[model samples]
Target: MRHLVVPFALNALRRGRSIEQFLGAAGTPEAPGIRWAELRPTAEGFALVVHLAQDIGGEGSYDLVEFPSFEREDGEEDFGCQIAVVDEPLAALTIAEKRLGAGRDRWVNQGMAGDEYRDYVRAGRPPCLSASQSEAECPET
Candidate 1:
């Protein structure tokens, strides 16, 4: 089994839902098992790197999974999983994409702009800032 880096961003795991739950929800029947290595918090949010054993068939076929922290109906901690189509060598790209997707939404909703906003995106090390940037500023990158 090859070691595939599965990037995920989650809360402190102190809540009722843990990373394991997120993985189960995101994983497909064919998906290989994952072993989490690190879960670090960044300026934007948390960063998770897990070693998984799976066969990534081809480009655009691999699934990049993410689980963002949320609150459960019972006021307990919860998370929701999201999946994305990714290319080969999924490690860095998966993390970058998750950060971009999550960060972009946060920025747009908060109306963040200027250098501070730029720095925020930069911190995530996104694969292609242009693709994740807002329509107005995307062409500038």
Candidate 2:
């Protein structure tokens, strides 16, 4: 997909979290106005769903993105610049930091964007991507 995603999701997942729970869990460094990022693995790579839980006076919607991972000529992982916005949710989207779980395997979506993040109370959703955080990574996909 081609959606813009905040970097907190990857950072928080590295810390053993699905969606970041505490404000400081993944809000450091840039401190996005909005919070929460969910990552799901795809057969070719992975998918990311970011929720902008808009306030009473704002608009809330789901932005989706995908990254196709591959191996380079040297046998090393080469996630090319092929970030595209996928229509599919990859998995159930969730805003709960704690319930979102961590990334699959050691891969985490690493990218940055915060101008879109807005304020919010909370959102409803699945228990996180803990069921299978196995294989995928997107560099700001």
For this target, which candidate reaches the highest TM-score against the unseen true structure?
Answer: 2
**Off by more than 4 A, model 1:** 1-69, 72-77, 90-141
lDDT of the candidates, in the order given = 0.27, 0.30
* Per-model TM against the reference: 0.17, 0.21
Which candidate has the top score in lDDT? 2
**Per-residue C-alpha lDDT of model 2 across residues 1-141, encoded as one tens digit per residue:** 323244444444334443311111211224222233444434533344433222222224323112222333467544222223333332223322223343323223333222122212233222232332222223442
Candidate 1 lDDT over 81-104, as tens digits, reads 222222222332345344332231
Q: How many residue pairs clash in each candidate?
A: 0, 11
